[model samples]
Target chain A: MDELLRPLVPQVLGVLVRRGADLATAEDAVQDALVEAVRRWPDGFPEDPKGWLVTVAWRKLVDAHRSEASRRTREVRVLHDVAQGPVEQRDDTLQLLFWCCHPALTSASAVALTLRAVGGLTTRQIAEAYLVPEATMAQRISRAKRTVSEHGVGADGDLGAVLRVLYLVFNEGYTGEVDLAAEAIRLTRLLARLSPEPEVGGLLALMLLHHARRPARRDADGMLVPLGRQDRSLWGTSLIAEGVDVLQTALAQDRLGEYQAQAAIAALHCDARSADETDWPQVLEWYDELLRINPSPVVALNRAVAVGEVDGARAGLAALASVPDDVPRRAAVAAWLHERAGEPATAAELYAHAASSAANLAERHHLLREAARLAPDAPGT
Target chain B: MAKFLLLKHYRGGPQQRPNARTPMEEWTPAEIAAHLRFMEDMADDLRRRGEWVGGEALAPEGAFVRYDGEGRPPVTDGPFAETKDLIAGWMMIDVESLERAHETAAYLSSAPGPGGRPLEEWIEVRPFLEYTPPVVD
Candidate 1:
């Protein structure tokens, strides 16, 4: 029942807001309607669930307004106005998304709010996912709602912020009860349906491509398996095909963005039968386009790695020189390039250095193993 | 997000060298000030990034206490004279992942030491046992 109703939350709230309901009150009313649904749906499903929710939530909003002495005058006016307005056939989820990702709220608050309002997640559920106290999550949600209300639902909502929030949720991975990545994909799919923006399609493709590789990303013991070392048999072929299809459609539009560029690179990786068979030149080309679009040091580091595969290690090292020194994984990148260039001693030293600097235990362990493998007289070798 | 405690010890940790060492008291005032400032800046940066939960510096003094017996007066001991390990402080953070916690610890370990060099100290990164149950299936 929850799975069926969750997708309708944003649309229902959007309808109420469009009918002159304040965001906070409208959200509360919708939540009440959801609770009522959970109680009543066991007997039978409604033929028009969306309509039922809207009517019930609207009545709840009006009842609360009428009960308040200060809101009595405004209640009659609002009721009359809502009665006169035509039933909105338009999809308001896009507008609700814009409101949820308002610039006034911090990214954390925005993420929390988006999960609550758009994703239809309870505060306890979000709190559990984030490993924070329920009270803290509740406070964050309320504060975000207040901030959005204060901003007054501006016409020009930043799509970038909405995309960013979704991306953030997707990257948060599946630690909590909810599969945030799946939730993110579901939300983005909805957004893509409502908004015909190519970037939305691009983001969806990127997420699908990355998510397809997730099964092969870690070992049974939860240790990370680097892309080159992952068991190819574990990769999701169907997801890869879907992602490629999505990326191709988005690319056909010719309005390229960062996500599309990234998805292109991922698709190239997916196309390869083995690490050695990877189309390094094509991957490097996508990275170049990504740099032109985003120009981040992280992208530059990745480009340097791709350069090592396309050109020689020496060329890759030269490219790495342009990336800032303080960037993470510099030593690991240097080690990989040096090993490929047949400089074993330097590569071993760099691997050790990278191990010390590595933040993730799995990565650190991997680097340490690499260093030990390259040692002059490794034990048991 | 997961919570982690970045523990700083006054002495006796995994990386504490038995012979080659200089205590903070032996450092020059400028070096000490630089190290302190670096720590402060790290906390500030964590706060700005919305990762910081709380942090505090512990005094060098402490005590051990135990119950003498049921319904009896408690027994107390003064701070140990030759304690090998002493907790200096701790910074609690709520970060996106264990990787991020490790990154923050590494950054904090880079605090300046004698001669304006990185201390390269060993910081213990301990995960908080969450009270909330896992939401995942």
Candidate 2:
């Protein structure tokens, strides 16, 4: 099914772009057409599946226009142009991508909308991905659609906004039910074809490298295991090699975006034979480049860890203190850095607090384990 | 047609628990308005289908039946307790089928509030059953 739908994306998107429609609407119409074809085409497949989808979706939009009184006249005016166009020549997906990730929408909403329309995800899938209820996701998408209709002027302006939206989606840690990491990679690969930016390639490489080790990141019961504790035998060497290969090519492009820098960090980590051999200095340098570009406190907090590994635990503790209190993972990082700096009592106290404050059970357990290891005589034991 | 009572449990007078902290507000003003709009739309849809009995949004959490101790008759109160987890309001509806009731629930939950967030709190839907018993031999 994936193979069959793969080739139809460009053709379906081409027609949608030409229809002068929003990506959300175009995607809805296309999905409606796809459902119809799935129901009817069991005897034999159509030779030109893309052509059929374009025709069906075009008709569906007309029907939709006729049903809604406000859009009737506007749609009627465009009917002639839609009829005259050859669907194959148009690049609908690319246009839809830009429209869905329009700068007017918030970054979160843009990623949500793009995942729905371009990534072919249902509201349930998106809601699961974000740990929101399905109803909430549905409402979010509906409000976004209304906003686009009432406020947005259409997708004639910026593509960088769209690229940033995709990258953000990639960075969000997996939760709920959907694997956003995989979905983001797929969208980046698709977007790379439309606009082959080095950052796009870099984002893809970064995702691939991280995802390659996903197997070893957690235990059978879903507890997080740090890189030093992870079983290296479980890592997918092929994915690591592929990610390295992609990052190398992207680095050669000389664009040097934040994503490329992040990918470079991942590549260096993947290159090390063991945890001790991992180049903390190189990772710290790349993180500095990332900070120069993005200037995020989260990035600063991460860089502090590298600095600690390279410079010493006391320096890392000071760096961690410089980060804001509310930033995610602040306490855990602080606890670990404090532990390394010969302050076991302070480390255990912070670790216990961090464990209690953890959002998920796995993280709580991991934090508690570190706390217990640091203080054998602690009461919780 | 079947009728549904979206029952909100409002205890009359102030809450007895002194240590209860102030309830965290669920939705802001914008969220409440959006939810009202959704309820209005749902009622309108039901009315159009000839299945809507009549629904009313109650006054804030203060209005409810007050129970008297020692088997005395219950009285009503205007401004209610300081309970944080109080039900703000409810809606009663008359529908033709269980499916329609579910549809109404779905539509009501789809209303948007702050930052495009949905006002998705739990809503209970129960059937109004009518049973006919057989005569004894």
lDDT of each: 0.84, 0.69
Estimate candidate 2's alpha-carbon lDDT, on a 0 to 1 scale.
0.69
lDDT of 1 by residue, A1-381 (tens): 879999889889988887878898888889888999989988988888888888888878887787765546866566756855545777888888999999887778889989989999888888777866676677678777987888777788899999999998887677768888889999998988887788998999888888888888877876567789878889889989998998888899999999899889989998898988999999999999999999999899999999999889999999999988789789999998999999988999999999888755667777888898888898764
Count of backbone collisions within predicted model 2: 4
Give the number of the best model, judged by TM-score.
Answer: 1
Best by DockQ: 1
Rate residue A115 of model 1 by lDDT. 93
Model 1 vs. true fold: TM: 0.76
Steric clash pairs (candidate 1)? A177-B135, A177-B136
User: Which stretches of model 1 miss by more than 4 angstroms?
Assistant: A63-87, A359-362, A372-380, B1-81, B84-137
Reproduced native contacts, each prediction: 0.00, 0.00
Q: In candidate 2, what are the lDDT values of residues B50-86, reduced to their tens digit?
A: 3444455555545568778878988886553575445
